[model samples]
Target: MIVADKKPIEEIIDEIKRHTKILILGCNECVTVCESGGKKEVEILASALRMYFTNNQQEMLIDEHTLERQCDHEYLEEIRDRIDQYDAVLSLACGVGVQFMAEKYHATPVYPGVNTCFLGATEQRGLWTERCQACGKCILASTGGICPVSRCAKRILNGPCGGSTNGKCELSKDLDCAWQLIIDRLKALGRLDDYETVYPIKDWSTDRAGGPRKVIREDVQV
Candidate 1:
């Protein structure tokens, strides 16, 4: 899932302070699981902002709403009727969701309430770690399910860099060497022989070098 972290309240206040009527929109998807931009987070942020404004002798209209998803067109339509009533919208979704909401309501200003982190997994409660970089090409099939592209400090493809020591990355002792993990995994699977076969240089064109990407699946098109 996409992981995100909350922005500082002072920064948020600075952004929407000029607007009298503000809408704090939440998302019920990835941000919800990450506890950054969910319904609960939205309510908490709204309350904090309300209190801040009240104490400052400012009268602000800050309303809260949570959408099933801000990235989907169907879900975003739910707010179309009431969108115009607000001076601005503070979207507590991923960066994608914030952009989609802004595009859907071009006239209304959309501000991001959270900082989009990366494609990651929840290691445990309150702990999320990066897993994939979405390079547009998956190499997990040959790499024993360990992703060096995302895990390696230098993004090495072939083997562990000399910087690794005792199964830990040179960058940090807590960080496991991506290549070491791959070799261990392959050994366990009895696929150590596959390691001898060197992988070819990855095609750079398939990644972000091409710029904003889109997929056109004819079968799934309406």
Candidate 2:
């Protein structure tokens, strides 16, 4: 899932302070699951902003809405008729959703209301850990399903670096050595021989090195 963290209220206020009317838009997807930007969060932020404006004798019109998703055109179209009512939109979706909304609306200013963190898993309530960098390649099959690109401190593919000691990352004692986890996983799976195999240099073009990326599926086209 795409995990995100709420932006500080002060920074958010600073951005939209000049606007008399604003829309606090939320997403019901990943950001909601992560508890960063959902219906509840939108209400909280809107109320806080309203309080700030009211306390300072500023007349501000702040409204809130949550879409099934901000990334899709269908869900975004739900607000088409009412969109022009606001001076600007404070999108509580991920960075991708904010950009998509801006691109679609074009005329309105769209501001991100949260910091896009990473593609991660929910370890527990209120806790998320990075799992994938979206490097456009899958090395998990060779590494017993552990992702080195995201979990490893140095992103070492071959094996653990000399810096790691006692299965802990050199960067921090609390951090587990990703490669060590891989080795243990492989050992448990009775595939320890796979560790001896060397992986070639990763192709950088498949990653963000080539700028924006896209995938097409003609089968699902309109």
Q: Per-candidate RMSD vs. true structure?
A: 0.6, 0.7
Clashing pairs in 1: none
What would the per-residue lDDT of candidate 1 be over residues 1-222, giving only the tens digit for each residue?
Answer: 999999999999999999999999999999999999999999999999999999999999999999999999999999999999999999999999999998999999999999999999999999999999988899999999999999998988998989989999989999999999999999999999999989999876767887988878999889
Q: lDDT of each structure? A: 0.96, 0.95
lDDT of 2 by residue, 23-127 (tens): 999999999999999999999999999999999999999999999999999999999999999999999999999999999999999999999999999999999
For model 2, how many clashes?
A: 0
- The local lDDT score (0 to 100) that residue 163 gets in candidate 1 is 94
Please give each candidate's TM-score: 0.99, 0.99
Q: Model 1, which residues run further than 4 Å from truth?
A: none
